[model samples]
Target: MTVLVTGANGLIGRALCERLQQKKQAFRAAVRPGVPVQPGCDVAEVGELNQATNWCRALTGVDIVIHLAARVHVMHDKSADPLAVFRTVNVDGTLNLARQAVDAGVKRFVFVSSIKVNGEATKMGRPFTEADAPNPQDAYGQSKCEAEQGLRQIAMDTGIEVVIIRPPLVYGPGVKANFAALMRAVQRGWPLPLGAVHNQRSLVALDNLVDFIITCMTHLQAANQTFLVSDGQDLSTTELVRGMAQAAGVSARLLPVPVWVLQAGAKLLGKGDAVQRLCGNLQVDISKARDLLGWVPPVSVEEGLGRCVRG
Candidate 1:
């Protein structure tokens, strides 16, 4: 099957492309203009992912399209209208590509969405499942929810299979943003005030996510289904920090600070949302994926963290 992978230069995209190449899968990489073409792969320069951006060259003769390009969530968004900006790329742009893919005779479209579409966090012991109604808490989440809805509608109208995979906090080698920063902090032996905070969060390794995506590409059970994917291992903030320290062969200097005090400090500094993420319960149940597709995360949490730190 010929697959078209958009956002070929992104963290997940780069890894997915490498895996595809290793497996000898016939695929094309869709990158934005000016980005260097990936050597030894079929590359297409699809400029400016938006409602009007042309995807004809990328979708040509493709059997499947993995839509990974989107306006990812920003912690400190400087846009005047954040929701509108998100909608332009995540909603409008996604639907545009799906519609064009249908015209290109693509049989399946796999969309990589975020767990934020389920909400910022779940209640303790009440992990999010595919049955949960969408409760998007941010502009980026809302846009993804809209895009999913639009894609479903398109699937119904055109008979093209749609598969949606929502992953939570994907991390592994080459990870950046908060996860990477935490690793650096732990490596530097910085004392972290998360010794007492015990909130569970689910994370997916980059390899596991890529493997699941490849499975969905041809798995008949994956069609028309929304799957939540993770490493099936949950960790608290303290445990996560300690694990990083262990991987780096360093001691984690954790301060036993109260969660309420941290919350108060974050609120005072206008970082309440950020702190909540660090000290919140955001877990997803991946039983649907396991039972339906017989898919399992090949890499364990310990191994995934080790690879991340080593990288």
Candidate 2:
């Protein structure tokens, strides 16, 4: 079956393309104009993802569409209307592609959503599950929730299959943003103030996420389902930092500052959100993906962290 992958140059997309090529899968890469891709790739230049964006050319003869292109979460958004900006790309653009794909006789659409769709953080020992009602806390999360709702409606209206996968923070060799910065800081032996913070966070490796996405492409049981995925392991912030440091061949020098003090400092510095992310209890339960699909993370957290550090 022919497949189309949008945002083909992104971290997860790059790894996915490499895996698909290794497996000799027939696929096309959808990217913006002027982006460098491998030679001889079936590239579709779908510029500026939004409501008005046209994807007819890209969806031609494509049996499966993996919708990964969206207005990603920004740490410090400069947009005056963040919700509108996210809706234009994440919600409207997603539905546009879904409708066009349905019209093109595509069988399945796999959407990569964020765990933020469930909520920012889970209560201690109360991991998020697929059955949980959506409680999006940010514009990005709200847009994804809306997209999922729209896609479900599209599926009902058009009989095209829809699979939604919500993954927590994904990290790997080419990871960027906060996870990458954490790796760099660990490699540099920077003293972190996470010794006293003992919050559990779940994360998925790039390989694991890619494997699951590939499985959902043609798995009949995956149709009309929402799945939460992770590495099947949880880690405290201090343990994660220590593991990263170990992988980087450095010592984990941690300061034992209380979580309350850190929260106060973050509030004083207007970085409360940052601190919440760093010391938050955000765990996802992947029992549905495991029990229903018999899927397991191919890579362990230790191995994933090693590759991230080595990179």
Tens-place lDDT digits, model 2, residues 174-201: 8989898888888888888888889999
Task: Supply the global lDDT for candidate 1.
Answer: 0.94
**Candidate 2 Cα lDDT to native:** 0.92
Worst 10 residues of 1 by lDDT: 32-41
**What RMSD does model 2 have?**
0.9
**Alpha-carbon error at 70 in model 2, in Å?**
0.6
Task: Please state every model's RMSD to the true fold in angstroms.
Answer: 0.8, 0.9
lDDT of 1 by residue, 253-288 (tens): 999999999999999999998899999999999999
Lowest summed lDDT over 10 consecutive residues: which window, candidate 2?
36-45
Q: Please report the TM-score between candidate 2 and the true structure.
A: 0.98
What TM-score quantifies how close candidate 1 is to the native fold? 0.98
The Cα error of candidate 1 at residue 273, in Å, is 1.1
